[model samples]
Target: MGNTDIFLDKYKQLENCAINEFKLPPDGSAVAKLEKRSEFKDIKYELNYCREVRNLLQHNQKLDDEFPVEPSNKMIELLDTVIDRIKNPVRCIDVAILDRNLIWRSYEDRVLPTIKLMNEKNISHIPILKDRRVVGDFSDNCVFPFLLGDDNCHIDENTRFKDLKQYLDLEAHPSEVFKFIPADSKLSYAEKLYEEARNRHERIGLVFLTANGRSDERILGILTAWLIIGQ
Candidate 1:
């Protein structure tokens, strides 16, 4: 009926989330399950604190004298937020689906589709994959000079991916413009990589999402500044 009641209700909801939603082990008590779940490894102490407080709420039929029976709205809000995040951890694949910029094409495929993808999607940076791996990045900025200049040879939209190889510099700067991470990575992990690259003052034009977060892993998705920033 009061703030404390509301707080207790929220804690129940959180426990339900742990069991049904996150699928924490049902072998022991809720506290045991919270501690056992590897997903809470990063915040075990915080979880312990919540368990302690929730325990007091459950066992202590206290007079309002022992503790603040009425927790401040801000306190409840903050704790709820932590529980919510624990319930719903964001993975890189979750961010991947948000990007309409994913335009994967093989080097042997036609270049026209790449151009159309750029215009329609309003995207410039792209990964050119060969045999399910990213070979290089492609963009109008890199390919435009050839189109603008009066090159002796004429290539049209029908020109396949190989044709652009002649004009576009496919050489990737090793220090700049990408790194790979698995789809299961947390968004924060990806942001950390981006930050590290920026701190090194590298170009960091794109981040290639792969199945296992390795050079040999199959490309699953791509990440750009906007997609990460927007989230």
Candidate 2:
């Protein structure tokens, strides 16, 4: 027989079996005319639990004569949905070059107009340069050395900002503290640089001080983790 014929025959058999258990109309037209409002509403939870029980029985799990199945909205949400927002975060990452003309100083000497420039431009960390060479990466807190009694805590106009020449060239303390991350580095590597700064327990801020690693260590940019995320 055709698929439709076979389906109709099975449907008739099911209707006969159900009619044997309940008082069903004998006339096909009377049965088709029967109208009843559905009593069940919002039974998806129960249906899902019953499906799970059926699966457990098929899998040969413990099948008791009578068992209770509890459904949790929390587990349903977890298993049914892809939580991408929690697993992955969107972070804007970029780099900016440090202005070579910029100067810096402690809290003492006339407040160093560069500090005001940095504030006006929304620049948080400013690197003190002398003769196109980096002297110190100065944030708002670099003024502490001058607040104590240090008279020479100032970026003189004639001083040259030391460039990152070699790996060993960055061995100086507050004076010659030269450290930087490349602009071509990945975001994870940039994060690691900031993490290392945190682990050092020093004021050595995470400065993505950019330089041309190919030609020479030219001051191309200066950045931080905050700048990376902000980008």
Candidate 3:
């Protein structure tokens, strides 16, 4: 067949992939549904344009026994890209900093050195792990409470994460919060969570990807706004 036939075939594959991947209603407009997904936000216009082209190709009358319009190579390439994205959706774990590469500290680890490292690296948050599981997190927000809790509270060579235990709890930070998501969670879902938090005037300090999206589970990876923004 011609390029028109190939375009139609690819478009059909995209629709099917999207329907099965996103569980979109078979009777509804796939492009419309995809528009609502964060993953498709960047290509919304292209998707709509492709749909319009498909409609024209199928319904518009042919002239001189030839199709009225032909899809461009770029358009076909876009369809292929969209199809690939649908079949291999980016997961939160794909962008997250894996535990092995994560910059973290244990409760017994010296706090001063960790803080120094954070300063040098411009890291805003540090997870405190115990038994290979997240017990709490330390950040600039934790500093205020820890220091004001007592007149003698101070950070020195002897200071350890255990000393800031109370302030390090996930709930201890009033201005920011953390979320646990399963390793296989779609990146779009994580983006939605962050957007929802922004709508509520709250901030998501970090997202931890675990085996089952539970705080008590072993941490597999971590997501930050910086990481998501990069994607």
Best by the lDDT measure: 3
Off by over 4 Å in 1: 1-69, 72-77, 98-101, 144-155, 166-176
**Model 3 weakest 10-residue run by lDDT:** 27-36
> What is residue 122's positional error in candidate 1, in angstroms?
0.4
The Cα error of candidate 3 at residue 93, in Å, is: 1.1
Rank order (by TM-score, best first): 3, 1, 2
lDDT of each: 0.68, 0.41, 0.91
Clash counts for all predictions:
0, 11, 0
For model 2, residues 3-23, the per-residue Cα lDDT tens digits are 323333433443353344336
Candidates 1 and 3 compared: the better one by lDDT is: 3
lDDT for model 3 comes to: 0.91
In candidate 1, what are the lDDT values of residues 69-150, reduced to their tens digit? 5555654674587567766778888878433445667778787777777889787676777776777667755566556557
Off by over 4 Å in 2: 1-94, 98-111, 150-178, 200-206, 211-216
Worst 10-residue lDDT window for candidate 2 reads: 31-40
For model 1, how big is the CA root-mean-square deviation? 8.1
